[model samples]
Structures are given as structure tokens and as C-alpha cells.
Target: MGENLSRRSFLKGAAAGTMSVAALGALAACSPSGAASEAAAPAAAAAGEGLAETGSYDVMSQMSLLNRNMTEGAVAAATPEEFIVQKGDGALQFAPGGDPLGITPADFMQNVPAWLGEAPEITDIAGTESCDILVIGAGNAGSVAALRAQEMGKSVILAESQTYDEYDEYACDMACYNSKIFLDKGTPEVDPIDVMNEYVRKALGHVNLQIVRDYAFRSGEMLDWMMADHIPAEYTEKYAKTSNYKGNENFSGQCAGQWSWPAMTQWRDEETNINMWPFVIRSLHTSLENLGGKVAWGYQALRLIQGDDGAVTGAIFQDIDGNYQQIDAKAVIVCAGGYGGNPDMRLDLSDSMRNLAWAYGADRTDPEMIGGMGRDGSGIRMIMWAGGTMEAGPRAGMSIGKNGAPGFAFGGAWPCFGPEGKRIYNESMYKFGSNGHLDLMPDDSLLVNVTDANWETYLSYQGYGHETMDRSSDYMVEEVRQNMADYQTGPDGFPVRSFARFGKEYSNVWAADTLEELADIVGYTGEAKENFLAEVAHYNELCEAGRDTDWGCDPQCLFPIKDAPFFASFGATGGQPSNGLVMLSGVNTDGQYRCTDGAKAAIPGLYAAGNTCGNRYGIQYGTPTAGNSCGFALTTGYCAAEAAVNDLA
Candidate 1:
């Protein structure tokens, strides 16, 4: 999913004298090709001429001349059009314009660099050590697990694929699109439970009930814990406000009805402990060391080691030096995130989910673009290999922009694209309709609509304290509205103002004059586009009259789409695709977090937490919710540690 930057970071720490170009050269020279001459002088001579370079090539040539000729003959038997473009920069440029035809020139060229038909083997393990409890992944869950276990007086080792400093900032200051009410001004009151429930119902069809309940019930407490630990409480408040309240008069009902309950709005404030995701990891890591718990950064867990009885006994990992080592543990907690980082695992999860991998491209660059490491689904796969059942497809704890548009920024009230982009949807509409729409539509389907009036209304509304909408709110609104209106009217209207911004692309905005045309331009067609436009037209008519019969869209709020040359752009449902944030299905465990296989479960030493355990909620995201993944990780890790200590006693 991402490149390993630990070595780079470590290399940065080396004294200037220790790290020389000579060292790099020496490493390169150690390669097989660099040492080829040592094997055989004749082979080295042949390699220089690109002839039968090695005995291996001679063997291949002798065995495959006839077969190669036959293959060539078969290929030549076809017309010139059948000839695949040979490998070269030129061939790649002209590689059969669209989608490629039967082994395209591009494919042929691509295959040239792929000398081996198989993937290269990975045989490196970074810094590894033993501990009584080993926590993999250093995100929200892993940090909590390590803290909880250490608090229980257990010797723990927390291993992260990346450094603690880098992991700490992963979420902090990394701009993302999140709908949460800011505590700055007139933010509406929202119930955490109702908001989350609606979120779950909308996102997952109320199928995974327990996960929703657990998250909702514990989220407030988690916020409190985070605040106490120095993360800003305003972050929670902001998230709740923009995401849950959506700025309606009956905010509580809107939240409760939606099954989302209030989480503290103060989470966004760095001063408040609510922004504790990063601070907590940093603090806990420091605190764990103070408590005599070991913390190893830049160590990647390669696999879980199990005894003959199949009980997890330890973990194998790679250190910064690329050395494999095994560490024994009384208990192993897999807190690595889901497959959002692993494209192949994502593809294998489900065809429907494959399209979702591109969703995060909006907020952050593609995983490939960022060279982000640590998304291999190794944690999920390791558990699966050990007979642990996976929940349904991955759930979203992140957001992606519409289509594959890049440079989409998160935050602010409503669906604000990066700086200077127009507001896409009425924030209230997100609270009222998105959950239901998400429930009914496919993952790739667009749920929100934007008309001239709605765009104007959104601009005006955001300034009225729609949570995260702040100082730049008016500017952002005006900029986006003008761009959209200009795109609708062309030169007949005023010249479109350009908002010079970094990483911003006009292509990010998909606009068309009509719903059908918009859909066609955006690659949605036929019944999908027709039905969507019909829905928009129907909604617009309702807005004109001020009543929505279908979804009870507020009449006072209805913005007409009657403006000539209507425009529609791709927008998200203000939520990431489901990416397994909380798993509702897993090994049945008691209140104590003990694993039970239903009939005399023998793995007494085994325990599960977070997404690894079974149902704790009925259905919902924050509605009537309890805890988040962090809370559960802490609680269960603590519970497991306590049980282990007592058993030993």
C-alpha cells in the first residue's frame, strides 16, 4: 500500500560519516548482476553483448527455439492489426487508444519489464522483540490496546510498521472531509446515538447491529477519555455538529431519527483531548515506556506464530535492518487497519468494493502517489489464516471523492472540496437524506444533487454556522457558486474567477447542463442516470412547493433547480465507503471478552477485541451508541490482561 520509509528515516539519523555514497554503491554492487563476473568470465562476456548471457539463458534458448518459433508463427499468422506493440516508450504512447484490444500494445510493452512471470519474494523482517503482549498496528486501536494492557501491569510491546512520530501525525493536520459541528458558534445540539444509528442504517442496512451499538455507546466516553488525555474536545464537537447535527432546528430529532447520537463537538480543537488520535499515540507510547512497557517503532509484523494447538503464541516481524525475528507473547492483538491500503485485497474482497478503493483519492492522493506503506491487510489475513472469519466487505472510516478525481480536500461544513471549491450539497440534506440514499444505492452511485438555487442556498447557509464553516466559509461558498454558475452560463455571465490553489484541479468538478448529460459526462448512463435525474427533478419540484413527500425534505429549505442550464456534479454521501471500522460478526465472546467457538472452546489463552469480537450493537453508527474502536480496544485489552494476570496468580 505504501513504501517503507523507516530505513529512510533511520538513514537520516546516521552520522554524515557513516552514510556515504560509497555505502550505497557497495549495497548496489552486492546484487547478483553486479557480482556476475565472479561466477563465470564467459557468462559475464556474453551478458555484455546481450547474448546467451548465462547458462540459464542458454538452457532456455536450447529448449524454446522451436517453441519460440511456433509462438512467433502463431502470432504472425494473424494480421498486422493483431501485432501487439513492442516494448518501448513510443509503443506505450500509441498503445491502442481505448481500453486496449486483445493483448494491447501497452500490455505487451508492460510485459517486457516483467521478466519474471511471478512476483518477487519478500524475505525481510525488521526490528523484532518479545513481550508478554504484542500489539500490531499503532493506530487508534493499537495505541489503546497497548495503553490498556500496560495500565493493567502487563509487560507489553507495541510494534508499528511506521515510526511513532509519523503515525502520530497521520490523522492530525492531514486535512480530510468530515461533517462535524464546530464548537465555534451557534452549533446545533445533536444526540450521538441517533446520528450513529442513522449512519449505520444508511451505510450498512442495519445488518451489523452490535458493532453500531458498541461504537455509539462508548463513543462519548471515548471522547471524554480523549479529552482527559489532552486531545481537543472541540474535534468531537465539530465532528458531531457538522456530521451529526447538519444544522437543523430539530437537531436532536434529526440526529436521533438518523440513529446518530452526539459525540462531543470539541474534538477538532488540538488543545482539547478530542484530537487525541495522534496525541494519545504519542503520549501513550511515551507513557508505556515510562511504565516499563517496550515500544518498538519501524517494526512490521510479518505473520502470527501459532502453537500446535493453533493458539497465537507470538508474532514474526521484520526489523529496520531487514532481519526476521520472532517474539513470544502471552497474547497478540491485531489492531492493523482494514484493506483500504491493500488494492489487491480490496479487489479480492468484492467486485462492488473495488470501485471504492479510488474513493480516498479525493482527500489524500492515491496510496500509490503518497508511497504510503502499511495497508497490506496482513493483520486481517493473518487472523483469517488462523481460522478467524472475516466480517462482510470492508467498511469506511475514511472518505473518497466522486469518481477518481484527485486533490479533493476534507473538512468544513457541507461537502467543501479543497480550498476555494463550491459547496456541493445542502448540509441539512446530508443529515436528512444521505443515510437513506446510501442504504438504497450502490457504492458507486451519486446521492446528492446540486442546482443553482441549492448552490446559492448552501453558500448562504454555511455562513450561518453550519459547524466547521468558519472565516473562509463565505469565500469558499462564493467561489464555488460562481464557478458552478459560470460553468452553467459560460461567457454570457461574468468571467469565472480562478481560485489559485495547490493540488486543485478543475477536472475535480464534473458539471453538465442536464441530469442526463451530466451523468453521461461523468460516466453514469442509462437507467442509472435517468433515474437519478428523475429523482432530482422530482426533488426540485418539491422544493418549488416547499415539501418533500418522498423523504420529507423540508419545504422552507427546498432550493429550486429551475435556473436555465442546470448543472450537476459528482458529490459524496459525506461518508467513506464501509471499510470495516467496526466488525459486528466474529468469535462469540462473553462480557469478559473471552473467545468461545460455541461448544467447549479450547483456546483459553485466546481473546479478541475491537473488530475481532462479535456483536455489541444492534444497528446504527452513533445512534444509541456506546464505544468506538479505541474504547473497545482499550476495554478488551484491559479485560484480557486482567484475566491473564489473575489466571497466572
Candidate 2:
């Protein structure tokens, strides 16, 4: 297959009226999920309907409809063996080792995407730079890699697409195991094996245990080294003191009963107002520059250069001014983030991730700008061109539930009703867990969140991320009320992106003194209206009895809707069925942070870290703590540098 064989290219062709239904089906044979659905007549029929009627290729709509059609009368498939593409089991599942399934990377991805075409065959380069190590991307991982290599006395060059002033930096908490900071604070040390096993369990054994082991055991030392002279333990102490923590028990096992620990460390300097990760980025840059290392800002990697023996020797980079340059290095570390910025790459991985979450910082449109943040898939593609494989779908994403009424954290705790007014989730699950169910709902139907006047009381039940009940301040409650008031006072017929044209006039937030009026305001009629009222009444009953018999919500989260002036927030308030902050998977790698070939052998001089590398979190982006990704990035960058240093020596 040449350049036109990619699924994304085919969809564009179909949308442009160059392909027919038969041609689409022929292309579907290449897709793992599409191939499985082809054997099921209902799914096939729905696929045909979706393709034939729609002017453009909306794969998620087609796929969602196809799954709904297949599950209409069929029982939920209990195992992968029973149904290759399991449906209607809350979340979608696929056969293991198959496309959209867990374990190994998809077989089809062994072939690179045709869209990349071929790298520029430029002979006359504007510049040719030589370095001992070349680290692409100056984000969290690349920055560390460059600094570590330079610190190891290697001539390092850090190539970043963005300028020095515009380097993408964000503050974040990082996960580490048994750091001195934690030890001094009396935090418990965790077993690295237990952490890896838990990750494997969640990923259904789709993880690289060795790579995770590197992160699990070595991340603390990496953190300690990075934090040296930058972040102070006193800063962490101040943060701990200000936290409104009810207890560690309340936050335990928040990700579907996954074990959680106090291993997550954040640098909060409320006193000096310095952000941790940003400061770390600046510090790394300063140290690298001070060590006589160079940072080639505004240079993007175009392709990898491999030797005759198939070892990656160097790479080609394109500057913003349409100029080309070659950088030859003993080892090239690719930590240029993940592919979340590219919609086609995300769609290629999992249609769910592509259609479900909006990518963060995805507004870059320059031809030279591959992706914003580390989300440009260029680094992964360059490695793939040099024969690196990627982790297969259904890939995990980091959906740190931002959906809710503005300024409120109780979106996941309220009673949620689907389009037919049926209760969808337990609403007590973590935001991502509950929102995942909402995303897999049968159709792109309207979903609403209903809560009583005692919305503030629900704050007590809210755990993790935005917990405020332990604090004496009523400011959060007031803020939520004010935000709701502002939403209600907005003009009618506000456009909600998720809603179709028919519901454009429906203001997303609605309020009324009575349940009936609230239902009317939300456009519920006939059976839907009755179902809404019934669900609310049943929920109130459950709340009064201090138990949720229907959805089995936590008893503590069961607040009654008996109070007057009940509120209903329309659309998906728990979590939008869109791209999360970022897609967490990437090109597959070995324990040493080397991007490996299909045989799982390290490609001699290529390494990857951060989101550019994969097999860390497994099938889903679930982690033992909030900052695992950040910690893994820092650790892998440091480790990749060490590996390169040793190999070069």
C-alpha cells in the first residue's frame, strides 16, 4: 500500500466523492474493528447506512451507530472469545492482540502511515551540526535528556520546534517512589512490583514490565536529582499544610478501585508563586546552556537517518524558514511528546479517543508546526520510518474530567440522565470512569445532570483533584452558585458543540422550582419526560434510604432531590466525549528507553521518552498516582541519556 492506503486518506477520499460504499468496505478490511464488524450483518448494515448517507466521514458516528445496531437484541459479550468486538458492556472491548484490543501493538501499524509520504531528499543542507547526542523536543522529557547527556560530559544538542521564549511549559505534580522528601514527611514507601502488577492488571497485560520497572524503581532518584537546588521540601510542606484533605482513605482507589498511594509529589510555592514543572524546565535549560550544550530552537525533526546496519545514526530537521539541516549524532533520543495533536494519528489508534476528547493546545496551523506542546506525532513517525512499532489501541488517554458547570466539581456526583431520561452511570465513579460510560452511550444523544438545592452538600462527597469540603471556606460553593447564575442569565439558544442543530437553541443550563418545570425546560416530553421524573424520584428514594439500589452509587454521594428549585445542566457535564488533555501511548520501547523494532530489540542509537514512548501505562492511562506520566517522562529522559552515554563510550 502506498500513500493512499491510510484509513484517514480513504475517509478524505470518500468525503470528496471519490469512493463508493463498496470501496469503503474494501478499505474497511484493513481496520481491525472494521474487519470484525464486517462479519456481523447488523454492524455492517449500520456501517453502510452511516457511509452512504453522511456527506463526510464521521467515523465515530458510524462506529457508534454500528455498535448500537449490533447490540440491539444481542446479549452483552462476556469475553473477547464470545464476541471479537464486545458491545454494550459499559465500555467497548475488542479481541486481544486484535486491533483496538490490548497486549501487542496492532499488526497493521507495522506499515507506516502513507500520509508521511517520504522525507525530503535534500542534498544541499543549510547547516550540518554534529553532536554526541541529539535530543528532539525540549519539553519535560527532552529537556531532561539533553541536560543529563550534557552533565555526563557529552556534546548535546536539544532541538525544539518552538522558540526559547515560547517553550511550552506547564506546572504539574509528579509521581516518585520513596523520595527523601517523602521519607522526611513520614510518607510510606511502596513496592515497585505491586505498582507494576496493578498497572498490568488495568492494562490487561499490554504493558512493558521492564520499562515500567525502570520508572517504578529509579524515578525517585531522578526526581531528587531534578529537584536539587530548585524545589524545596518546605514548598511541599506548605502545600501539604494547606490541603483540605479529609483523609488519605477518601482518595484511595479512585480509579476503579485501583490502589492509590501518597507517592505523588507536587511543588507548590504559594509563597513565591513559582510553578514546579515550569521552573524545572527553566532550570534544566539553564544548566544545559551553562554546560556548553546547544539548544537549536525552531528546528523540527523531519526524519531519522539510519546506517547500513539499520542503527539510527542521526536525523534531518527543517527550520521554520523552509531551510533544511542535518544533525549527526552517536545517539538520538526522541522525547517529542505524543500524537494527540494529530487527529489522523489519534483516529488511527482508536476512533474513541479521536472523537471523544479534545486535544489540549491543538490550535497550531503552520505547515512547519507539527503539533503544539509535545503532541506533534512527528517524532513518533520519524522513529517509525526507522522501523519502530507503536502500542496498539484501544490506547489509553489522560481524561482528567474537566466537564461540569463552571467552577463546580460535583458534575460526576450528580444524578445524570441520558437522552431517553434513563440514568446512565452510578455518578459516584471517578470523573473519567463515569464519563467513559457516558461517551459509549448508544447515540450522540443529549445528557443532563440533575441536582437538588443542596448542591453544596455534594461537595463533601467529591474526592480527588478538587476537594474543598475539609476547608472552612464557603467560597467554592458561592463560586459554583455564581457560575450557574451566570450560565442561566446567558442568552437562550446558546450553541453547545455536542448538540446537533435541532437542539442549538436549548440553553445548556436549566433551572426551575419544580421537577416538572425543570423537565419542560430541558425539552423532555412524553416518555422521556416521565423517565426523567421517575429517575429523579427513584434517586430521591434511594437517597432517603441511604442506598442506591439502581446504580449502586456510594451511599455518601446519594443526595436527595426533594428540595425546591432543582437544577439541570444539559449536555455532557460530567465529561465531554472529546479528546482529553493528551493521548498517553506512543512508539513502543524497551526497558532502557530505547525505541525498539518489531522484534523488540533496541534500535542501536534511538531512544524515546515522555509521551513519545509507550508501554508504560498499559491499555488505559490509569496510574497508581496522578503524576505517573510526568515522573515517567523525567525518569525516561534521564535514563535514556545514561543509556546513550554508556553506549557511545
Candidate 3:
């Protein structure tokens, strides 16, 4: 995903910034970081070294200074990718003036919950369940942490807030590599150094680099243990459904289990919005129980107890029966999900996120919202209250993708109707397919997309009339060209089932027959209506021409509309957009997964796993590939367990 700063404006700003760069270069000669440049600027000083009167550099130049090293080629044949890099990935990455926003401690704390102000119970209460390791939050990371510690034969107590009958609000495929399963399936072992470097280059800019190094080196062994012992054989087939995204290319060794229609049809329909990770989750539950570890399903963590010597001594929890459950242990692992489910916390982080939050029971009156998956950052806050630091920018990771609403084509141009019934963005814009979602997210204040049967037919070419074909299918590939040559017939009739239950339930998708009728229903007004009709007419002309004169729709994808009985639905994202997933950020920790103090030193007896920890991501998903979220949860949980066990020893 990228910031919405248009390229035309960025260049205008860059050309101007060049002058500022020159001026700044001259000034830097006398400053600390640019002493050598001062000697180089003598030509300017002689000609009134204050050639402050040179190029057309304007105020925009100050913001566009990431490119101060550039003279030209902002978008040369070899440099178009470079432009997006300097420009930014989203609203937060770049300042309004076009300069990168400076990193701060607050940025790291954006998703971490504020410390609860409840007065501490000063007196000691005796008699609690004693264990070698105490784990909070039994999700992906917590399960792995508990299981790993149990394997070391440590007495363990794994606690979850939801009762025995309840399940996690969301689940997905796990991303990982170098497991026995991948090798058995002929998948190669991935190179740790390459993956680590890529994480540094693309995701984390100037952030610290230790935690990732720890995971990158040991993740494979963790996977080996998972496939060999942690997972029960009965669940092996379910876990075997791995999706090796990009495995055929640069990511030849990495893989994640996929979200299959069979495994997650309810998630597909948005009725249950669950993931396949629960298979492994259940297996983990069974394995941990089988290993003589106790699980407390409805234990809500309150806070950590600190010792006079500064090591974490124990924890306080609220159990389902409304009684306090104190747990004394050698080490405590906090793996509760991040703050995606917490509005106050999210609002504290970025006011912009308020609109993005899928809050609890937010209705149609607020179409931008949905019910979050309940990652309320309780563990993150407790860890911080015990003196843990949050990671600085190049900070939290955000899930970015279409929000499963009817809108623009993510890969290339199928044409999207924006606010007024006109195509929203230049079809050529998504040519940089890497961050296309940044361009496709609803741009208008309302953030809606309205399209007709032609779009439905266009999306259908690859999948079940629309959305099923697999990314691995050859038939899906050729059909796009075939459909453009001769448009496919409209699906026998409107297949209302294709729309997710949540969209229909929330009233986000609407359909009408006549163009004006459809426009009126979706709120396209007089000017917007006129522009939309004009846009459709122009689009047909472009399709006929086999060349996009207007916005440069690809020659292969320029199918035009001219049919009746049209349809429209919201949540038409390729899959549910990344926003539907948990927003990942948390308390900063050290190489051993110990929660770090403000000075970045370890806070003894406290460790974090999964989203409670940071440095596996910065700004957004660390790896371009999917599954990094689940993979990090798994590997980091394992690594944290190892460190905590050694410390206890």
C-alpha cells in the first residue's frame, strides 16, 4: 500500500525540492553531518555563496527532501519503483508537505494499551497455583509458548479469557517455513539471511534488528518441532493444506496454509469470519493438555506483580466465576492479541484509525465500521505497566488490502466506479501491482464502489462466475484475454449468494436495473450521474479502440459495459481486505523476547510472544508474502519459550 500523493504533484514538488536540496547541501557544509559538502559548495559562495536565489524550489521542496540525493530519474525507465519508495506508503508515512514523518516513542505505543490506573493491592495474598511458566492468552502465540515450555517438562498454566465454549473471534492460515512438512512436500528450506535483509530493506527502515534475527535463524527448527511432535497426527491432514505463496519464485522455501473455500466458507460468506488456524489451535490445545499442562479457559489477566529485585514475580487474573486467580511462576509470557479490537486504544494511537476500526456492534449508520476480532491489548498494557518499552517507528504492522467491498480491480483495470459513477483512479495506476491496495481502497469520504454486470462478468472470468478460480489455474489466466475479445454472458441470473452475508446483512451492497436508477439508489447526484454516463460511454469507446486514451486501461482488460439486470455488492475485495485482520503492534522487547525497559534493557521475568512483541514488523506487514503474521506468531512464541526456560534455569 502507498500514500495517495499523486505522481504529477510529487514530480512538481520534487523538481522544486531539488533547489532546496542544493541550498540545504550548501548549508550542511557548515553543519555537523555535511562538513565535506561545504568545501564542494565554494562555486556557489563565490557567486554569492548564498545562491539562495537559484531554482524554482518551493515549500513543497522541503517535504520532498527524501529525494535530495536525486538530480533526475524520479520515474525513469529504471526508476518508477523508486518514486513510490520516496513518496510513501500511506497518510501516516509521509507528512502533508511530502517529507517522511520522524519516528517517535508514541508511534511504538500507538496500539499498546495505556496502563490501568487501578490502585495496586499492596498486601500479599497467599496460596496460589504454582507453575514453572505462566502463560496468558491462549491464541496462536500463547498456545505455542505454553506448549514449548511444557515440552521442557515445566509445570504450565495456559489461561484464556474466553470461556470453554467460546473460540477466538478470528483465525487464518499460518505462515512458516523449513518445517518437516514443507520438506516432505518437496518445499525447499528458505534462506534466513535473504528473508531477514528483505525485512530490513522493505518493512523496517531505521528500526532495531535483533528480534527478527532471532526468529529468522531458529524458525525452521521450531517448525520441525511443530510438525514432528507439537501437532497431533489426527490433525496432520488439516495442517498439510499449505499455501506456499511465491514459493515458485524468490520465496521458494516459505509457505503458509491457505484459506480454502471448504475450510472457511463461513469466513468467505462473512457470517462467521473465522480462519483455518483453529485446526492447529485445537491440536495445540490437545497437545498441551496431553503434556500434563493445565489450561484455564476463562482467565482474564489483570496485571503483573513486580519484585523488590525488579524481576516479575507473578500475575493477577480474574477467572470466569468472578474470583481472583493468582498465579506464581518462574516466568510469565504475554501473548494477547494487539489492540485492533480496542477503540479507545486505537483512537489514542491515531484518530484516523477510529474510522477504520470494526467496532463492537457498529451498525449500518456507520458503514465504515465492523465488529473487531477482540484483540484488546490487555497483555500489552500489563507488560508495559511492569515497565516494558514500546518499539519505535518503523513500528507496528498494518494489514492492507481491499475491505471485501465491491470496488476497483486490485491486480489491474477492470474499472471501478468512484463517488460519482466515474472510474475512480487511472487504470494505469495499479501497474505497480505491489502496493495496489493503497490505490484501490475507497478514496471518497464514503469509500464505496458501484459497478454493473460487466464488472461481475469481468471478475467471474477467473473464479466461479466471480471469485472462485484459483491463482494456480491456467484456465483462469487465458479467460481474461478471451473475455476481453468476447465478453462472457452475464451469469444466468444474479447470484446473490456470491455476496457475503455480512455485506447483505449490513446493507452495504445494492442493485438496480436502469443506469439512472442504479445511480440514484447508490447516491450518485446530478453532476456525478452525468459524469458517470459520460465515463461509461468513453470506456466503451476505449474498449473498441483497443487502447486507453483516457486513463490507460490495459489493452487486455478493457472490457466495457452494455448489459441490463446489473448487480452491485460491497466487500468485493480479492479476499477480505487486510483491514479486517488484527492490527499488529506491541510492547518493545529484546533479543530474548524479554520486555525491555525504557533504556532498552531486559525487564527480568517478563517475556512476550505473538503480537504483544514488536520488531518482527515495521509500518506494515514485514514480508510482502502473506502468512508472515501467523508465522511470526508461531516462531516468536517458540523463541520466547526457549529464552524464558533458559532464564528460569
Per residue, candidate 3 scores C-alpha lDDT tens digits across 1-649 of 1245344444455555543666445433432222223223222212222223543223222333333544465444357777667657432223123321232334334334343444256344433788889988888788889999998978889989988787653545454545556566555566777656756665535434776775566666776687678666655653344433212231112112111111111112123322445645677778899999989888888888888888887788877877777898889999987876665554454232333333222232232342334487788778877888666643322544334224332221245666656675543222111134433444342323444556534543221111222232232234433433342222222222212222222222355666666666556678987887788788788878888776655454466666764444333223222234666567888778899899888888999988888766666554334445666777888888888999988
Query: What is candidate 2's CA lDDT for residue 587?
Result: 86
Q: Candidate 3: list runs displaced more than 4 Å.
A: 1-115, 122-126, 167-169, 178-183, 186-194, 201-208, 213-221, 238-240, 244-276, 351-372, 393-414, 417-493, 496-579
In model 3, where is the ten-residue run with the lowest total lDDT?
257-266
Q: On a 0 to 1 TM-score scale, where does candidate 3 land against the true structure?
A: 0.60
Q: What is the C-alpha lDDT profile of model 1 across 1-649, one tens digit per residue?
A: 1244233332443433565676556544442332222222322222223234341233222221222232343444254444534322221211111111223333223322221122223445443467788777766556666776776778888888886556653332211111122333444444445544554665556233444444445444443453455334453443322222234333233321333232323123322213434543466577678788877777777767778887878777776677776778877777665555555444344323334434344322223322112245666665655555444433222222212112112112222121112222333443211233233334444433344434444333321211222222233436555665555432132223222221232334444555555556544556655655565566667666765565554344455655546444344333443433332333344444444443435344555555444443323222122223344444444444455555434
Error of 2 at 568 (Å): 4.3
Between prediction 2 and prediction 3, which has the larger lDDT? 2
Candidate with maximal TM-score: 2
Ranking by lDDT: 2, 3, 1
Give lDDT for model 3.
0.56
As for TM-score, the candidate ahead, 2 or 3, is 2
- What TM-score would every model get versus the actual structure? 0.51, 0.66, 0.60
Worst 10 residues of 2 by lDDT: 495-504
How well does model 2 score by local distance difference test?
Answer: 0.65
Give the poorly placed runs of model 2, Cα more than 4 Å off: 1-112, 170-194, 218-220, 230-256, 261-280, 320-322, 347-374, 396-412, 431-436, 440-444, 452-530, 540-547, 554-568, 572-578
Q: Give the candidate number with the greatest lDDT.
A: 2
List the RMSD of every prediction in angstroms.
Answer: 18.9, 12.8, 13.3
